[model samples]
Target chain A: MSEVKSKIKRVSALKQRGKVLRDTNPLLAVFQWGCNHMMNEAELVSDQPLILDRDFKAFSKVQVHNQYYNEQELPNKFKVKEYCPVVFKSLRHRFGEDPADYLTSICDGQIYGGKSTGKGGGDIYYTHDHRLVIKTLAKEEVASFHHTFKQYYSYIVECDGDTLLARYLGMYRITVHEKETYMVVMNSIRPVGIPTHRLYDLKGSKVDRKASDKERAKDLPCLKDIDFEEAQERLYLGGDTETFKETLKRDVQFLEKHNLMDYSLLVAIHDCNEQTPGEIDRDVDVYHVGPHAKDLKADPKRLYFIGIIDVLTVYSTRKRAAHAAKTAKHGARAEISTVKPDQYAKRLLEFVSSMLA
Target chain B: MSEVKSKIKRVSALKQRGKVLRDTNPLLAVFQWGCNHMMNEAELVSDQPLILDRDFKAFSKVQVHNQYYNEQELPNKFKVKEYCPVVFKSLRHRFGEDPADYLTSICDGQIYGGKSTGKGGGDIYYTHDHRLVIKTLAKEEVASFHHTFKQYYSYIVECDGDTLLARYLGMYRITVHEKETYMVVMNSIRPVGIPTHRLYDLKGSKVDRKASDKERAKDLPCLKDIDFEEAQERLYLGGDTETFKETLKRDVQFLEKHNLMDYSLLVAIHDCNEQTPGEIDRDVDVYHVGPHAKDLKADPKRLYFIGIIDVLTVYSTRKRAAHAAKTAKHGARAEISTVKPDQYAKRLLEFVSSMLA
Candidate 1:
């Protein structure tokens, strides 16, 4: 109804279209662009003060139009959103990341699946450099993330990014081909160039918590609580248990305070004799502990990898209902992922500390 | 505490910060960065099919960290969000905007306030070439925009970008210094080089809709509905009355259908005899109607600037409440901006068509 008629014709006049990033899917390409865009924007505004509680509940969103980077492989339009940028940007800063470099790592890198042995249904990707892990989130998990975002961010800031919790570098939602994918980027637990003989997802619950026969049939299967118990794997904390326990205690308290359940202590054991810890790739491990390799009493028998993973589950009305259902099904004493936050935290800490000796 | 301690030290490692756009504030700098980022990203995903109704509610968000450019002037960290990118991106395509060129026009070019004669309370900026107008939106106005966003997009698509309403290009929210600013970008109604000797805001309402004496004191004051009536100046719509009225009729239907109120037709009359319209820079006016200069009937008497402004108002509960109060205070027959959508649309169409005759 505009009388103007808009006859100028400027849209097609430019004709200079940017090429898409080479060799990727529509989702990944759009995601990469969002990452690049976000980092670039973050760099301009990172000098602001630390994130507050309210900031964690907020998001910085971007919408891409026709002239995005790769027109050929990517969709002409899509939506990408980053939740709690203030919290994560500071988290990245505390982790000593250069924003520009972060942009390159995500945008330039190829994002293929992280070679899952097929036990898990969720899709996961490893950054080309194997530094960052991009894990797809379920709808409910995404809701849980938002539900506890404020609490999680506060805990991270209070601990000064020093906790054992999985370092969540970023969270994003990208809509492609009419489907929405929510993802969270974290510091990878799987170290490159190091053959971790075994890995365990320790929830400290023994009831039906063992890796199935089908799961164990695969190479590099993620062992579970029962397998860990059966192996009698004592954690080799390298005699630095005080500080480690202190931090772990604080992190568990945080999980407990927020009613988070089902989180695990990811454990990777690297045999020192087979691969000496002499040249430790510190950049590859954010949760390793020892008298530094340069110290005189460095142990050659074992190298331990530890970080708390799967902290996104919060006990909400839905989760509470799940807990009730599981209790009814497995009887009240069953060890389930939906245990009350307090009991869950108490059991997790007890299991982990007993193994540390 | 993180056992790694991150001895790699990368912050000082990469000291080369990307250059900020020259001569801009932190808000504008981050905005420019966001535009560039979004454009780069959209290119990759622009191949996606058109947006559906569900897509209208979606958004793309990004969070930046410590490495944001122009950290000194910008907040250490802030947020930039673009709502409903899928719809707007495609809508931009319909209006003939190359995503890349739109990027350059907003990000690369120098952005300064559109030279206002200083009559309005809100801030308005123009692209360097004066092509786009960026105006701040109030909190309620932002909500209204979202409320009507779906309907507005659907109407635009149905009409093929044919409407007297402003070509709403984009909407963004940026948080800086603990305060958030909402902005909308639209095609400017000011014709380049054509001096609009007089401008009037015609709402067709007589409820004390007159510019105050203080407002009249300004160098280029915006005359109101009362002033317009007293002047008794009929709109010179030339011989093309049928199409204009038809467009007006349809536009009114849209406004009424959406329960919108308080919007006005912004009129700027460029006195062509003062400076012949022959050397008219068409690029300066993205909405010019006449065929190029060679047409014999091209009148040198006048150049009119027209576009609907302030269309974000919706007849929400609050507006309905206001309407009741106004009716009680000013009597039902008294005219005001808070009139019901039906009566409002009818009265508006009546006033405009009457002006044309």
Candidate 2:
């Protein structure tokens, strides 16, 4: 009788544990499921020496059924669409990310930070290790991504994944309960272990480009171009200046050619002097040492991690309308952010160049 | 401002809805995940003309990593092992189950009935549509299944899935949070649409064979051989009597040859007269018209659906000891259920034969 009682107790306890693990957010659950399964499946296919035109358009869609006992916490039915798996796999390879490690970082543990919303109304999340960022995308943004992904892939290939643009690892469209969520996974700009003392989103615009009071009240506010200029901030790259400028110019040219605008140069500054001893995880925070760190002019106080983000937005009719409105409001020569792609790229390069010491 | 507030409200509402769907039971979730994934994958492979010896031992294992945000309600890590995919696929094909329909049935909807516990301490679940039963298995039972699966597959092939034995659909071993749960999916013996008026688990034994008071108190208790004897029940097969007897003898002989014992003939009686109009779903309740329903001796009042279950148990040393203990307690000639396979099968046949009218 006692054994039976204990057995029943154990069973109920296990059941209770299962109840706790039930996925309350099935959209995220299915996204993870899709990534894990698709990545594993993608890994099984041997690497192709040359990228095919068809690869850019390749997508895998799966409809999942979670009926009856199986429908734990997830919707009884849902769908996941993975876009450009082969291209993303190639991008991940070019970016020097081990597929297994990337998978582990993205899908092996709990991801944090869905509370923070992006400017595009998409939720932003970070992997527990902070090596990657998963940003939800609006449907139009997903359309924009699909529109420019081929050129994006080509650029990444040409640059050998060394440019400042966000390193896209994967993209997926998850549909749960008839609602669709587009998400893109990319390498985080900030180093995983380092504490950023200051961050800025620089688009070379002076008109209404300051961070909001609400944003300024945060522990680490993402300031704007005006904030950077007011603070008299400058990056002391020493001998790496020319290489950085060349890469920046080339990336800007690529974006300009594609008629893309409204992108920001995301900069994160780590005050090395303020960091505690052994606070850095070198393995995870690979960006801590800049390219040509050894050639730096003995300014040991700070390190910077930077990347270009929000590059998916094109200078389409929607942006042209916004550009016209901003021009009228702030005057045609107000250095407004929503300029044409050519003017946007030129002003951004000049502003960024002035910040180099 | 109102628009922003409404958007926030909508987002919060979606999040709340997601919270409701969160899976608390990771074990069942993973089981469902594994089944849904593996079955879909199996369907993609073209059918093999012949089953090789290697196919019998073939299995697939997947290790899932659910780190950070991806971890949601699932454990950070878990593993799923699918055993004998090819053999099971073959078995399913032979059993006249459409692979696509089977997948949809198991994974597309909510599976019900994890509350009922089988005698082996395993939880029994029914598919939402009641076409299948999913039973959790002990590790030993998994081993026992593996031991006899080759013969089982061969027997299934020889009989062409026409035997009265329980139809085994799929088997899986799911490991979550370091705990392992083995599960088997099979066709439910009882008809789906028709309500069973009485159910019996007849093992042809007089000792300790009756349903307990607690079991009898249930809405539909699984009565035993003693209860059946007490009720003086009989099956009137009429023109189908000889054919039914032949099938029973053949099935018993097969079990005996394999050293299997302690199996039960599960009987469910559906009273047509007591059933509500339109209650019977002919499509789902395929068994309503038994194999020889037309020749069922002019019995318009009742329909019987019967099958052999618990056939995985083998007459090993453990069972031999139980047989000896029971024989000593009840005297050598007693019709004990725990006897050697040959004796057990003979006695079961004799008892079943006596019920034929």
Candidate 3:
């Protein structure tokens, strides 16, 4: 017994000991762990693969299976497949991010955004810092992203950061308990440190155009069509409306060309007291939006952050049937959440431009 | 919104979800993670390095400084080093264990044995299966292990596991938060799933040879010399005394040769109602003890798990000084848990063999 005591004494005297932290929960902790695991694996992939034409149709998938013994904290196994990994890695760099920092920001930290799974059923996750949004995508959406990934890359390159479309950073397939979850990460509509007083997901539709009572109760409700109409919120491009509208038209034209539909302008409004006209121009990518008008007084302190989101859907024969079916339910004359690609593009442009002040 | 709903509908129809478990805690979980990490790294160590004469005196160290990321679950970093990795890896094989299974059983499952850090100030850990004991070694003890490791390996080879000495498996140096902890793993005295009704750590000295009332309150308290003597127990080696005594003698002589002291015979009595002759031989490692003679008809089923533990101490100059200081306090013939190596070995063998049953 005294010998046991002596051994303990020596252990206490152990030099330069490391700390061990308790996990938040098993699932979240394992997710963080898996991020480390996959990132390490990703390091093995040949760096900067030549961007080939066929790379658009390619997907890099990684599967992990733990057969026996690791059942304590982890189950028998899991699989994580990254879609078009090379493209995404390139996209990461194009967005001015380092892979290591990106992994840390996404996978490390307090993990705050577990907003209730919306009516759509798939979960949406926002990183603690609000710099990233991890949104669940359907298998069809993943296929659609792969379908357009090459052209999408070309468009971003042509215009640099001027496009208004949701910038696709990375996509993944995580299988837990054998259920596959397709997720895509993109930049949040607003800057991380900025405070947003209001936000909206505008589809320019009239029917079912307001936030539900529950959605309205949220701290920053993603309000919709009639809600925006009633609030009379307008896009103020200052005097640079032509340039901003050109980027929007080109972005929408790309979606329309691909027969895509049902995307929206995701908008966040940050109200700051120190609203100098050029404050935003100095801070954000000036190419993203039109410049502030020299004539307008900087009386009300507000800055707008907007980007197009939810553009993965492509109109096919199946969507034609949906268009016909939705027309029957919502009526032919009224604007609905779903429509044909050309009609959706025309209606979105007219509705958005009509809001310019 | 409809598109999002449709995707959700599709996501719901997808199949084969796997479970993600919550971690037990941060530290223990990280230990599990680090095990996976180090084992993967171990794959790179060249196999069967030439066992040089001086190899027994060496160590293999790894220092990890993760400057970015993994700060939540792990510290910004950690270090893990193996003591004579090649020797231990070979030792693992010599003990009839596969490295994979060993790693799985140890690093995968929920860790179970966190023995109270005794007065000696080190914690003892066991795998959930209880087949192995992870004990913390002092800096001095680690040095002493290096001193005697070569001879220990030779002794095990000579006897072919037919002795009472504890089997050494592997040694490690782990640093978390800069603190260094020295650990060594060995075979447990009691086989997994075996029930020991009473156990005693026997040193053969009587200066303080009784279990405290607190110790007696334990389900299987480790009683001492006076307790054993008061109970009036005797050997029941079933007429195999000749073989058992020889093994014991060989083990003690080896200890005496090393000039070590303060070792103890960890004895456990598994009192059962289904004791059948030769049952132990059918189940346990037969070489560990001599078989019971077929004549005995004791009905109560029991299995005694006996082995030597705490054999790391050497009669170095510091130990000699402690011996002199203790001799002055308890008097020259007090047998105060510290004695000359030959005297300690002779006394321990006599006491342990006298109790075999």
Candidate 4:
């Protein structure tokens, strides 16, 4: 909790005093001084009015504070309900306990990220019931802190060991007497025990055009190490070239981000008399060669590590030329010593994974 | 003409070429880039494309020189027949000669102004054949500058050489292309003998609040020569009470660009009146005003010069305050000085009349 507290910057008391719009009408405040919240969407109008009443400051601040409290506290109420069948079944499969199934829905407590940054936090929502918004409160004392929805959810999922993709369950658009309109969203309960990797295949089908609709309906893309050549071939088959390329690029990134693959080396298990690349078993999950390599082409039991010995090969020459072009654009050193092939492989994999996922 | 040429910069030359795609495809060109020209009233794209060609060097100077010459020499086939009744009537009124009357339609060399620019220039289109579109000869010329239809009519009515208001005739949408998709608008002619001051009443009525069909028809609050008091009042009327004072305060600009009322000195006139305590019709327009002053009273002989004295008084005080503010902002004294009432009054009259004829 202290770590989480340190991560968030507390909203200053000066900002909370409602001093921001003393010279303008609160209703038209957004028009006068443009709203910083999603400011990109609206245009600023000239000749906006001013608010003059000093007495309204305390009342406005209290109203804002209460809204903050209401948002967090009310959202927790829906999580208490045990009626969700999907959540219940997932819990039973994982823990073999029907009575304690709903405990998974209970929040372990939210972790605040650095800021309410666009690239950072998770989006939290309340259930349809107004009671769910009370999750924001702590004994009616509003503690102001900033956090992004992405970071918030990432922290929660990691701590709770759940594989649920956050989904909006409901929303309430409420207007306060003196303040602006606010929308509070409620999210459905997430279940545990399912692997994180599997969730990507399940939810990713919506945007994944590489898989046919019929194939997607039957089975998701299996979470296994993909062959680099086959993936590149699929991309080049090219009915829709851009789409295919993007799909392959994202797939590579996904593998690297999750620490599943590298590019320069291949892990081979040859004791089963596999002669060609196609003979490799479906169960054989190909992993990238690690940085530490000694002997090559030894027995499987002897741990012969993956290695790229043909640096003078045509493929290696092409890779070096591509690297040089990129380096030149970035004003990097022209020397081959600056190139980090392993890191490049890792980044490439992550980029691919993000698109596929 | 040289002075006008000196003021204008030749930004770029555009080639008027269209692309033919499929049979159903609309003609495409560089000018229509980013625009929805397919829509009912669509014209040029919003983020206008670079109109000039990539290699901007003059391709052929002789070609452009010949192009302009050839266009002027070509006879207009759309000219009204010599014996036409409508042409005969217009020519009879214009020249009062039977031989001249035979040439029914004639080109009057004046650029029609008021309706578009809110300033009076020339009414050239009246005597010309209304159906004809006058074009430039160059194939590379852009359409907006290529042709103008003889749409508007203007007539001067006077008794004993004393000029009354130039009366405008009614407008007609002159279609130029197939399907009558495009139009050129002409001036709305008025009865010739109306007094010049009466043009304000006519212009005011043209702003139809009930004409829900036109976007510009919506009532736009025109701020003319509003003194500080009227300015204060209008500010309150426009917005809620909370923002009224603040918005007005921000708008109280000492060094007003006044370009906002480019057609008239009416805004300045209003401002002068409001600054003075008890004066009505501040006579600020009597001071140096420009062409956009149609909505103002400009009769110098009958005008009381008392308001001029008041304005001069206010101007001196405002000048002192303006100097102080500028010195404070820029940490230096500026060159703005207060004008004496008698001197300002004389200068104002000279500037105003210089614009009239």
TM-score on alpha carbons, each prediction: 0.51, 0.53, 0.49, 0.16
* Model 2, C-alpha of B154: deviation from truth (Å): 25
lDDT of 2 at B186: 85
The 10 consecutive residues of candidate 3 chain A with the worst lDDT sum are A6-15
> How do the candidates rank by lDDT, highest first?
2, 1, 3, 4
lDDT of 2 by residue, B1-357 (tens): 001110000001000001111245667656665776676546434457988787767776656543221233345567777788778888887777766556656644555666453456777776656678888887777888888888888988898766888788899888898998888988777765568899999988887899999889878888999999899888877677787788888889999999888889998887778889677654455444433121233355777788898788777877778778888899998877778889889889999988876
Candidate 4 regions with alpha-carbon error over 4 angstroms? A1-111, A115-357, B1-341, B346-357
Each candidate: what lDDT? Answer: 0.67, 0.71, 0.62, 0.22
Q: Model 1 segments beyond 4 Å from truth?
A: A1-24, A67-70, A114-122, A276-299, B1-357
Docking class of 2: incorrect
The per-candidate TM-score of the B chain, in the order shown, comes to: 0.82, 0.87, 0.81, 0.19
Which regions in candidate 3 have their CA more than 4 angstroms from the true location? A1-30, A57-73, A114-120, A273-300, B1-357
By summed lDDT, the worst window of 10 consecutive residues in model 4 chain A runs over: A1-10
Please write out the lDDT profile of model 4 over residues A60-157, one tens digit for every residue. Answer: 11001111111211210110111112221222233223211111121111211111211112222221121121112111111111112223223323
Model 2 spans > 4 angstroms off: A1-23, A115-118, A278-298, B1-357
The DockQ of each candidate is 0.04, 0.03, 0.02, 0.00
> Model 1: how far is A133 from its true place, Å?
1.7
Pitting candidate 1 against candidate 4, the one with the higher lDDT is: 1
lDDT of 1 by residue, A1-357 (tens): 001111111111112123334444677777876776565545544345755556666676655444322345557577788887767888787766656546655655566673344323457777666667788887888888888877776777677766778877899989887799988988766555556778788887887678878778766677988898788877656757777788889889988988887788887776656666656654444333321111111234666667888787887787688779889999998777568899999999888878876
Task: Give the per-residue lDDT of model 4 (tens digit) for B1-357.
Answer: 000011111122121111111111111110011011111001111212222221111110000011111121211111110111122123223322222121112111111111222222212222222222211111111121121111111111112111111211111111112211112221112211111111111111111212123322333322222122223322112222223223222222211211110111222113333234443333453332221122223432222111110010133344456546655755552221223333333333333333232
